[model samples]
Target: MGPTDTTHTTPLPVVLAGARGHGSWHLANIRRLQDQGVVRLAGVCELHPLDETELAAFAAEPPEQSADFGSLLDSTGARAAVICTPIQTHAELALTAAARGVHLLLEKPPAATLTDFERILTGVRDAKIACQVGFQSFGSHAVPAVRALVRTGAIGTVRGYGAAGAWVRDDAYYRRAPWAGRRRIGDTDVVDGVLTNPLAHAVATALELAGSGAAHDIASIETELFRAHDIEADDTSCVRLTTTSGLPVTAAVTLCAEQAGEPYVIVHGDRGRITFWYKQDRVLVQRAGHGPEETVHGRTDLLENLVAHLTHGTALLAPPHRTGAFMRVVEAVRNAPEPAALPSGAWHTAPALTGDGTRRVVRGIDAAVAAAADTLRLFSELGVPWALPTEVSSP
Candidate 1:
């Protein structure tokens, strides 16, 4: 249906689930939508009771609180639901929302497993309800321009790309939450770590730039996960992939960095290159014909874009469907074996170190570096078109 046809004449009331933690971000965003008259604050569904101070913050009349999803939906008279639950419950909650004929704005890593992710997709398709995944970067202003450059061959025939980011998390950080770095939820070991969490944006961006069709035919993927900390899942990972169109893409993510630095991705072609720096909010472009360097800043208007897409079938700048490619890569990475065997050192000697350190670190930094190099070399040997040294400079 066209956007105008779907646009609610009156503000549609929205019920928000998972009011604490990340859910609070959704609450604030919904409030912004309400302030703009895009949607009305119907109610909130949280596992915990709302304190008096929190309740008083709502400008709209206080909404009913319900622990149960069905009761919550009934109590609020909400037409749509925004779910920000833990990774494990996303699919079930989304399925429940779909069954209720409620549209959805679910957080990233839509489901713990590919099967569950597909199930949610099937539910959305079967129910004919509008569902948008939360990959905020997809809504960035630079996306269209970047896509245009790639489509128009501004970068010439896109040959390859690379992305990297360094994020630090201490033991206390993982201890703060029960599900911080786990690979499995219940019997299913779903890979949801740095790759699925922080680096998801980079993966989505790569797929978007590479185009949807190419994403559908991934050539190969190699990944290494490092449990460098006291987390059940890998906090550090590196992946190399080749698209069906013969374009190479590599991404490295870490929560074990000593310090935080900018996260960046660069796409290269015969004609030129385009680089995106997430931390700096800048895009640098260089072409064969152009002199010096040109840079542009990005302003992401996700909420307004989402509202427009919902109200009027306006083309979505970033749709949840594009995430499937990223999920495939994530699955491959989680399934890949560790590049090196565990160290022979006494386990007790490294108790103070992080989980991955005993094995990935105690063996020494040189060993870690060699293992990483070997992993990448194997990817290249496997026919992944990783650029030779002369093609691009390392970050």
Candidate 2:
């Protein structure tokens, strides 16, 4: 069939594959699309059998088939698939979907390696299908507003930026999932950790807001992985990067602190600073000579925007191509140097195990000891206060 003929005749039915954490979020987005009559929910594909809770959840607005990915696609006749699998499997799943002529909504860090990501990109291009990457913030209101300001010179000649936040994950968190802090996916030594996974969104969002893409110069990036509880990947990281335009950006992420929330980005230009809190969905613009900062709430209409773009030919706020650039930054961070070892006797002491409930207190102490040891090892092997590429320079 001809391109236009194929596009017009086929109804875009979406099958959600690998409905895990972010996959569940994608399912919600799919439901939103169905409610708005933008697309039909064909089925769900997950490796494990659905439990009673999962079955009941789906029964509310059940799909035609909820089975293995290939079976679900065959049974439901879906025209597209949204893959939210682990980082290691992204390339394979995306390539499979492309081969089947299915549109894709792939989660971020497109693949574990540059080669894998490029292969998926080539496949999607060859198939001539719509492929949307899950860099949700790109569709947020704050991104567009900041981009417009930067583009129009409202933030006169952007120079540098800074971002920091405390990311805290406890011992039990790592034990809960096998892939919690792992760099290698199965046997492949893929960089699948905080920088590539958790911090990917912020990195991409910052680049988009700054109106920059892949760095022309070798953008330097450094990372540190800590085992708060014997996990394989780094739980905390501080990264500094320079854009092709010479704008320096710094990002700090940690899963070892107990903080309420993290500050997002602070973009500095000749004119002023624009600060955004992602979790809070708030933006504050402070101009050079301005007395009071102007605040704007970021848009909560990301899913609707995605649907509108796919169904009505509307312009996407964050197209997949732009999203791909962000993934490149994620790769750079993953490739950074491992942190230096920590000195002996420079560790935080645990609280005494003296309480009325002696047994419980003792158990807690044991857990704390284990966690501390793990953290120390992580820092020693993978430096705690690690520096990014920008922090190290030639004299």
Candidate 3:
């Protein structure tokens, strides 16, 4: 968003698509790296151009802003692009960038459907371009550290992997975007549910810890989805998957938490268990014959990692293929019947913690989510009163 630093080696020309909303974060990050002589903010793609005031924070001189993404990339000679657009548009925009041989840092929930995921994946492969999916947790050093502890039997005989995300969102959250909390926007799938959009890192990182994060590594999936909010998507949901090696990985998440807190993934083992807070790259271990230990690990920012990959040939942290198993979960949710709306008796409205508009909170959901992860059980299996039977999928 600022002038390119050409005092040293030329910075990689980078275009940012959807330069508002979450794209704002990408814009600021580009400016940070731009100041450090890593990447230049070459162009910005937005539906409506940012006003002078809106663009004032980072853009010393406004980068080329245009609604036409492909033309902007071409005009700016972009070497890479960061896409933070709606979930449904990822494939088309990614392929457009790939068509011009631009590398990419595409945002999470790469596409609404696995078909589109494979389509874009194949195109990027055919182009031989580096495409990084924005699952930033995968960039954390703690991931490998947890695996190392497991391998060393610090947790001893991995029993299962469980992740829990309990977050709170106000009613305004769904109103912020046309596709927010939506399953499908007409025939085009949006799939903006709790597990797919907001807390997706929990699911992806859990599968990664289970060492089952590829399509072929996952054998089956079971999902129990429920909505406390009056949206077309689920705000409370849990998914359990069996790896090809017979490991169970489960994630239970909710946007209707009574009290917001950090989400965590736990490695359950026969001897003891390890807990990881992926966002913070922090881990805690309690194993047999050892007192509890806590550690804070380093993390590579995905965008910076992508830049390093292009300029220095560093390995991409979250290549599209590594997210295939998560996409499989998304595909299962897409094909499953609409999430059941919770009965009136099941949830109640409460004042938002931020004191804005109220958000629906499912009664006792915080415990339910934690229980599902701790036990690797579905909500129904936990005897939750309103939970419906899970829909299971096998490939």
Q: Which candidate number has the best TM-score? A: 3
Model 3 agreement with the true structure over 72-137: per-residue lDDT tens digits: 999999999999999999999999999999999999999999999999989999999999999999
Considering TM-score, which of the candidate structures 1 and 2 is the better prediction for this target? 1
| Every model's TM-score | 0.81, 0.79, 0.96
User: Which whole-number lDDT from 0 to 100 does residue 266 have in model 3?
Assistant: 93
Off by over 4 Å in 2: 1-11, 64-67, 215-219, 222-229, 298-303, 337-395
* Candidate order, lDDT descending: 3, 1, 2
Off by over 4 Å in 3: 1-8
**Which is the winner by TM-score between candidate 1 and candidate 3?**
3
Candidate 2 per-residue lDDT over residues 227-333, each given as its tens digit: 33344665555455666565666555554444325547677778876777665667777787766466665564444454455566656555556655556655654
Worst window of 10 by summed lDDT in candidate 2: 356-365
Model 1 gets an lDDT of: 0.65
Q: Which scores higher on lDDT, 1 or 2?
A: 1
Better of 2 and 3 by TM-score: 3
